[model samples]
Target: MGSNSSKISDLPKNEYLKKLSGPESISENDPFWNQLFSFSFPAPTSSSELKLLEEATISVCKSLVENNPRTGNLAALTKVFLSRTRELRLSAECQNHIFIWQTHNALFIICCLLKVFIRELSEEELQLHFTYEEKSPGSYSSDSEDLLEELLCSLVQLITDTPLLDITYEIAVEAISAMVVFLSCQLFHKEVLRQSISHKYLMQGPCLPYTSKLVKTLLYNFIRQEKPPPPGTHVFPQQSDGGGLLYGLASGVARQVGSSFSW
Candidate 1:
């Protein structure tokens, strides 16, 4: 009876230790959390581990975005991990499980994190694209290339061209960060992803095969520098031949010039 009582007495402490040691508890407040995040989202040079981290990141984003708020602000803080519409869908899914106000507040917090984490790749890593060399014969197999290509394609798809209601700047930044990391790791080499999809097939869609908003932002901001139109270059056509209208006809067409035209 005493042995059983002692074991029972130790149970609570055991549970406490488990919580303290687990991956879930490693947060910003914990000194170890940075290490965990870095390890989990390491540059792609650590291919095996990076692959695991990528899968885990996507799964967490899907779950938190879709249905899990008891997890607290972690999900909220990770909101930028998903694009805008995704957050909306996730919030709707979890509304029944959490207070609407809490969900809304959490979403704001998540967007802020995304905004901060993305505009942060170093210049050295950004330039890695130029130094890329073809893989030696046995280095990367065709299958590996295919997977990388698919991921690249997905990244491209996330970037949207919607005029006004597309993703926010914060979400765009996060997407850029993700692409920079992928580039730094050399995941999308010419021999790998670029070759997997033909130039023709890739340019067909409204968006590219893997064109994500994040990827699009990455391309514009990083891969291809979007220089402003040359100095003194006016984008709009010089006020037409009619001084801001086809002079008389432009103003008279809508009004009735002589007939008081009523639609």
Candidate 2:
């Protein structure tokens, strides 16, 4: 068995991909899927190898998203990938520029997948997405809510923990913009507004830390830049028309702050 496994592992990258991309659908319980889940890329010894590994991972992710037999399994896999990519980004050991670039690329792909998943969700599913078990004793599980919180927390860490010098301005803008779009969702926005007024808090408990980090980063960058954009320039590329996502985000955050200070 060990010899056979070694032989399989030694297969060329193209062969490996061909095998994995074969017509058989991937079930969560399938051995092939499990093997892929457990597979870790060896640390790249060269820039070329790093690029190859990154491309391979992207290919595999696209294939899984397309061919996975279960939505739940795909969601679970996405969560795992997001968590791993976050860990990699945050790791002090992962300081290589190529590695960091690859990590960001992986994050971009994962975010795209997440966007597609959210876009396809029905209104009923969207409602359920925000429902989570209360922290109180004997409360029913709210796995979906838990997952959402985890993702938010991860994004915050990704935004805050990564050094500004290391990350591209475009990626930084997109990350914060994504958060803004998420918070702007009607259901999420109403819930946050209610929480702010009733509980005397601006953002939800899980989102507060990230929100603070985001504000700090934005202010810091704005202050430190040699030349700032014109007064009305949008922070993100897609927000050129109106106040843009950043303005909306700032307003939302300011409201939260105001609620906090209200007597």
Candidate 3:
């Protein structure tokens, strides 16, 4: 228990967030959480280094999630992570290898963070408090719909544009595991998910593969919940009563969108 306590205390504190906004420029010497968002800080230069960083950062975040880190801190983490994902949308002209590497890294980060935070949410947190200032930690959730949409959009483009990127298959599967954990949360409301079927991107001929894959995943998860727990090392949040309703809405929308392209 003491070891877990040590890990929780290392989470990015309010003081560091303030310093991030101050005149002093951030350097690599700063904490990993702060450097993660710094423009000047060096991103991991190799796949192995990124894996190492993911393990370290996620180990800490797992502690924070279990111990209930402050809402403000959790909010800051989500905002910075989401901000980086926008870069993925704009890097279309880059070389294939470069684009693959960038998407791989982004998906890794997203998968790690989701797997950490998508645990069973309390009934109270489902109300969705917009303000994240100091208050009962149970009053909010950082699972933004924007994050979910960005993830789906990026995956759509990748699978449609480069079906042969075999390396991406491993990471994409990892992301699916993390994403399914959200099925029980209130975050899967129809409005936040409607674009999967409605986006012009899906109407294009090339995007058919992703649309089909998306539907299959939803249906798989729907059946998956009723079976024995999946046999994997990945930790899943305990299923809640609300998960059934949320999965119904999610599966329906995904199926509705895929029907036009389903073989």
Candidate 4:
């Protein structure tokens, strides 16, 4: 154990980051996972240190997405990673840790990476990526809601429950950006997202700290996502009714700008 510690400590930071982030295969047994799971801190305080840590997290996640081009393989890996967030208890509550994402930017990094994959991957590639798979004719091991929705709720908690500033502030803005991605891509679970944006926590934010940027992101995406019928033909209404709430969120933020309230 001491030898392993010395080796990890002796390695230059970039080399360590490169090792895991490189084309090299990083199994769960890799020391990288051990290090992430072992490191404990109340919040990420070191800018250079945590920046490299967060970057490493992003690299692994992106590699996972890129490596698993097949839908079946991606879904399998996606379910495992999402489930880890819950199993190890990642949330906005701000407790200290033994889990992989307990550090400051880690959870936010995960949220952002997930947004990238969800937006970039094809719909069919991700349909089963959200939740569970059946083992038999009619039985699933669990009936829990989509893990993606669970993570979305966790983002809502971070946005609403935590005071955004510094790194946390940056995280909040980016989290809203991620939510916009979910909206434009229309890849979210309806009921869970409704739970995320319900009137209960609208006061938490998407205003002030999140005001103009949030509104602009939503509005731009809303317009970009628009699909008018050819020439003068009437279009059918959306069956899934996916993104209406997000549009309302944009209008909601627009109404809150320059309110003269301190965040």
Best-fitting candidate, scored by lDDT: 2
C-alpha lDDT of residue 186 in model 1: 23
TM-scores of all predicted structures: 0.24, 0.46, 0.36, 0.37
Of 1 and 3, the candidate ahead on TM-score is 3
lDDT for each of the candidates? 0.29, 0.42, 0.38, 0.38
The 10-residue segment with the lowest total lDDT in model 1? 254-263
lDDT of 2 by residue, 1-263 (tens): 11122222342343434344333433434444333433223323233443343444555445543444323344443454465555554453555544444444434444433433343443344333333222232223454445555555666666676655423333344455345434443333324343322122226666575677766867775555433234323222222444433453344344323322221
Tell me the TM-score of model 2: 0.46
Best by TM-score: 2
Off-target runs (Cα >4 Å) in candidate 1 are 1-21, 24-154, 161-167, 187-263
What TM-score does candidate 4 reach? 0.37
Per residue, candidate 1 scores C-alpha lDDT tens digits across 1-263 of 01112122232343322332223422325433222222111122223433333333343334332222223323222322223334443443554222222322233223222222222322232222112222332122223223223323433443343111111222232333334434332222424443222232345543253445534543444433332222122111222342421221122222211111110
Tally clashes: model 3. Answer: 0
Task: Please tell me which model should have the higher lDDT, number 1 or number 4.
Answer: 4
lDDT for model 3 comes to 0.38
- Model 3 spans with C-alpha error above 4 angstroms: 1-59, 66-93, 96-103, 123-171, 184-263
lDDT per residue (tens digit) for residues 1-263 in model 4: 11122222332343433443344444433345434333222222223443443344555556544443322222343344444444333333443222323233344434434544554555444433443232332223346455454445555544555442222333444355445444433333333334332222233433335444445544564566543222111111222445443343343233222111111
Clashes by residue pair, model 3? none
